[model samples]
Target: MYYAILAYHEEAAVESWTKEEDAALMTELLEINDRLVHEKSLGPAARLGSTQRAVTLRGKGAGMITDGPFAETKEQLLGFYVVDFPTLEAAVEAARDLRRVNPTAVYEIRPISLYVPGTPLTARDED
Candidate 1:
C-alpha cells in the first residue's frame, strides 16, 4: 500500500535552527532514507517553503486569494513523504524512523486511495 506521511512542526522552531544544526538533523534523517531507498519503499518526498511565502485560496472558482496558509496554527505542514509499504504497521514504522531523528515534528500517515504516475519530462519540454 501507498502512504502519505505529512510532517508538521512549529515553523519558528525550525527556522531558528542554525545551518549546521539543520544539516546534522538532515544527515540523520537521510541515513534512514537511505535504508528506505535500498528497500525500494521510498517514493516522493519534499520540504515545503516557508509559510510566509505561501498563499491560500478560499471559496470557489477564482476564490479569495490571501497571503500565508489558511489557518493560523502553532504547527505548520513542513514537508511530506510518499512511501510504499506492505502494511500500515510497516508504514508507521517508517514514520517512527523519521520521528526518531526529528522528534519534535508530527507525522500524519494516510493511505493513498489513488496514485497517478506522471510522465517524465525532459529539459527540452520546459522550453
Candidate 2:
C-alpha cells in the first residue's frame, strides 16, 4: 500500500530559527531521508514553496481567483512524502520515525487510492 505523509509546521517559527539551528534540523532530516531511501520505501518527497506563492481557486465557472492558501491556519503544510508499505501499521511507524526527526512538525498519513482511466470511480478499491 502507498501512503501520503503530509507535513505541517508553523512557517513563522521555522523562519525565526537561527542559521545554525536550521542547518542542524536539515542535517537530521537528511539522515532520516537517507535511511528511508536505503530501505526502498520512499517514493516521491518534496518541500513546498512558501504559502505566499500559493493561489486559491474556488467556486465554479471561472471561479474566484485568490492569492495565497485557502485557510489562515497557524500551521501550514510544509512538505510531503509518498511511501510504500505493506501494512497501515508500517506506514504509521514510518510517520512516527519522521516525527522524531522533525519534532516540530505534524505528520498526516493517508492511504493512496489507485485511479484507472476510463473506469467508473466506484469500481476502484484499496487493492
Candidate 3:
C-alpha cells in the first residue's frame, strides 16, 4: 500500500469558529473520519496546534539546532493524516472528498515513500 499526506492551506487568516459552528463542523469532520475508517485506510489523523508553538531543527556542522520553522511562509501546517491506500488514484480520491467537506482549505496531495534495505534510492534517483 502507499501512504498519502493530506495537507491544507488557508487563503486568508480567520478567527476561530463559534461554539455552535464548531460543534457542527466537528460532527461533519467526524463523518469524514468515519468514511476513512470504513475504507480501512485511516491510519492516524489529528489537528496540530498553531505554528507559533513549533520548534524546527536544521543540521549544521557539529550538530547545531535552530528555533521555529525554517522560514516563515504564508502557509502553515494545520494538520495531517497518514493514510494507506492501494494506489495514488485512491489517495487522490480521498483528498478530493476531504476538499469537498472543507472547500475553503487547499488540499495538497503528496505520496509518501518507503526505504528498502539495500541500494536505497535518493530523492534525485526517484525523480
Candidate 4:
C-alpha cells in the first residue's frame, strides 16, 4: 500500500533555528531519505514553500480567491513523503523513525488511493 506522510511544524519555531541547527536537521533528514531510498519504499517527497506564499481558491469557477492556505492553524503543512509500505504497521514504524529526527514535528500518515485510468476514483483505508 502507498502512504502519504504529511509533515507539519510551527513556522515560527522553524524560523528561530540557528543556521547550524537547521543544517543538522537537514543532514538527519537526508539520512532518512537515503534509508528510505535504499529500502525502495520511497516515492515522491518535497518541502513546500511557506504558506504565506500560498494562494487559496474556493467555491466554483472563479469565486472567492483568497491568499494563504484554506485554514489558519498554529502548525503549517511543511512537506510530505509518498511511501509504499506493505502494511499499516510498517508505515507507522517508518513515520516513527522520521519523527525521531525532529521530535517537535508532527506527521500525518495516510494511505494513498490509486486512480485506475479507466475506472472510478477510490479511496484507500484512512490511517
Candidate 5:
C-alpha cells in the first residue's frame, strides 16, 4: 500500500535557519531519500515553498481564493512524501527516520486510498 507522509514544522523557526544549516539538513535528508529510492520504497517527494506565497481556495461553488495559508496552528505543512510500505508500522518507521534527522519537524502518515500520478506540471502565470 502507498502512504502519504506530510511534513510539518514551525514556519518561522524554519525560516530562521542559516543557509548552511538548512543545506546541511537537506543533505542529510537527501541521503536517506537516496537510500529509500535504491530500496524502491520511495515514490515522489517534494519540498514545499514558503506559506507567504500560498493560497487557499474555499467552498464547493466559485471558491474564494485567499493569500497565504490560513491555518491557525503552530506548525505549517512544509513538505510531503509518498512511499509504498506493507504495513503502517513500516510507514511510521520511515517517518521516524525523517524525524531523527529533523528533530523539530512532525510527520503525519496516512494510507492513500487514491492517487493519480498526474501530468507533469507545466506553464503557469507569474503575477
Candidate 6:
C-alpha cells in the first residue's frame, strides 16, 4: 500500500466558509472517495483544525509543556490524506484534485516509510 500526505494552510478561506460552502466541499471530497473506493484505492483521510488550539512539549527530563505550537509559522498544517495508488502519478493526480478546491493553498505529497521494528536506521529524511 502507498500513502500520501496532503496539507494546506492559511490560504484557505476557512474563516469565511459557511454551512453551504462546507457542505459543497464535503460533497466534492465524498465524490473523490467514491472513485477511489470503486478502484480499491482508498485508505484514510482527515481534515485538521487551525494551529491556534495546538499544544507543544519541550525538554527531556521534567521539561516544559506549552499551550501552542513549538514554532511559529505563517502556514499551519491543515489536513492530510493517506491513499493507496498504483504509482506516483496517481498520487500526484490526487494532489491536483485537492489543489483545485483550495486554489490559494499548497498541497504537499510525501510517501510514508514502513520501517520494521528493532531495525537500525539506514537513511533518515530531514524534518
lDDT of 4 by residue, 31-124 (tens): 9989999999898889988777898888987778688886567899999999889997888888898899999999999888755489977665
Q: Model 2 residue 115 lDDT?
A: 54
What is the lDDT of every predicted structure here? 0.89, 0.85, 0.68, 0.88, 0.90, 0.72
Candidate 5: C-alpha lDDT = 0.90
Clashing pairs in 4: none
- The best candidate by TM-score is 5
lDDT by residue (29-103, candidate 1, tens digit) is 889889999999999889999999999889888799899896667899999999999888999999999999999
For lDDT, the strongest prediction is 5
TM-score of 4: 0.86
Superposed on all Cα atoms, model 2 deviates from the true structure by an RMSD in Å of: 3.2
What's the lDDT of the predicted structure labeled candidate 4? 0.88
Report the Cα lDDT for residue 60, model 6: 92
Of candidates 4 and 2, the better by lDDT: 4
Clash count for each candidate, listed in order shown: 0, 0, 0, 0, 0, 0
CA lDDT, candidate 1, residue 67:
93
TM-score pick, better of 3 and 5: 5
Best-to-worst ranking by TM-score: 5, 1, 4, 2, 6, 3
In candidate 5, which residue pairs clash?
A: none
Question: lDDT per residue, candidate 6, 24-97, as tens digits?
Answer: 88798778778877878767778886666777778999888788674465666777878777677788888788
Model 2 misses residue 49 by how many Å?
1.1
